[model samples]
Target: MTDNKRFLLRRRPEGAPVETDFELVSDAIPAPPAGGFVLHNHFASLDPAQRGWMDDAPSYMPPIALDDPVRATTVGQVHASDHPDYAPGDWVMGLNAIEEYSVVVPDGFTAKVDVSAVDSPSRFLSAFGAVGLTAYFGLLEVAKPQPGETVLVSGAAGAVGSVVGQIAKIHGCRTVGIAGGPDKCARLVERYGYDAAVDYRGKSAEQLADAIREVTPDGANIVFENVGGTVFDAELMNLAKHARIVLCGLISEYNSETKHGARNLWQVLAQEATLHGYLISAYVDRFAEGGAQMAKWIASGEVVMDEDIQHGIDNAYPAFMRLFSGANTGKLILALD
Candidate 1:
């Protein structure tokens, strides 16, 4: 490839992102400075969090600057190296950008991958990737659910939420997942092993709350919230005393110009619930441990991993739009091959 292809952020989006907000162009491929290496990306992870990073707002990470290739977590092989610890052809995964290559160092999160450790290199972008690790740490470590506790997961059909429900079940808790459509709801129960599933397609926040209450009669002891706005408000309506609400993502509000604060926050006070915002970066030091456990679960029949892989980096825009469109069935990954 002459230089490299990049999907650049042309402008900050007005609402939900459109293709014009980003432009694809060839640019000079950067050389690794001393101690840095170049990653020839093969697959990059698409996530709702990327939408949040598009804006010029304060967030956990800096906003993606205009004219820059969009930020993404990518898995690739070393193309060239200036670092002693890394070499050509070494497989690595890092929080790189949406481009053909990335220049990075051995930051806390970037590390080499053992391709033989998994069936496919893309597995590093799915089950043993960001979403899986997020679910593992968020549910098991953050929520700290006891046996018999009711665990309700929002966005339950998505990559992370599905894993959260399964892990909760493995730990002996009743799992209820709230997803967008009936098909996703069905998969949550039949495919992902949720105890029950709630469809939030046409339901209002109040109605969704009723649906959740019907399934979790005693109220949920833990609310693993991903979809915010109405879905999150609905979850607030039914909370067990001293419930733990893990704030993972706000998929419903990420694209909106007007961000809506939760209307049912009073339920938190009423139920004495504790809501903690979750960031996967917090547990980066222990990814090896989490990846090992997930590998074991996959080797057994305990955890089923799913990926909706789209071929070609040219399809990045449409592939990413799948998350908001509810078209992709599993973890969305863009293949640059």
Candidate 2:
């Protein structure tokens, strides 16, 4: 295809992102120059982190410039290459713009994929990609979950959270997941092996706290926090002494103008809890080790991978919105083919 279709950042969103926040533009695909390759993107990984990247604020990565194709991690086939390391028709993964085609340097985050190791190209963007890596390092390295500990995960049915709960279970921790609806909660218990599941939908703070207390009678020793709003507040109320709180992502406040400041932070002091906020990039050097171990668990049937994929790049906008609305059960991916 000579024409590349891409979604460009139109404006910074005030609250939840709307379609108007981005503009879909079609342009001619560019050829690779020397030491570069042309990628025909087949899958775009939609993440909550993308929302933060859209804003014109100081963050770990620079914000996407207005009218530029939005930044995303993509899995694609190398269409053409001037780089000796990559050849046409090779499947690769890397940081790329949200377009049908991207020009990439052989170095940096771009790497050839081992198709034999994964079920499909989309799987690389899911469990085997940043999602699983985030869960693995966050739980094992940061939380330091101990066997027989009570582990609670918020946003338990999401890409990262689902994996977090399962990894906690593998460590012999009693896992409790807090998801939005009853069905997702059921999936946490039935499919992901969480010992208990709490549905936070339509429930008051008191009710949510009661539900958490019921599952974690001795209090939570480790809390894998993904959604940071009332759900986090509820978890804070039930923290055990020296509780380890892995502050992964705050999806609840990503789009809002006013963030939900946790009123119960004092509990962290009283309970002698350790609250840690981390970026996945911090563990970059050890990603290979983490990915290898996750692959072993998946291969042995000890860990299950779940994905909610939306076909076509045309659906990328609405599909991305699903993450905030809790419409996706696991990893949310946009398949271009």
Q: What is the lDDT of residue 57 in candidate 2?
A: 84
Stretches of candidate 1 exceeding 4 Å from the true structure = none
Runs in model 2 lying further than 4 Å from the true structure: none
The predictions' CA RMSDs to the true structure, in order, are 1.1, 1.1
At residue 10, candidate 2 shows an lDDT of 91
Which residue pairs clash in candidate 1? none
Instruction: Tell me the tens digit of each residue's lDDT in model 2 across 139-176.
Output: 99999988999999999988898899889888899999
Candidate 2 — worst ten consecutive residues by lDDT sum?
106-115
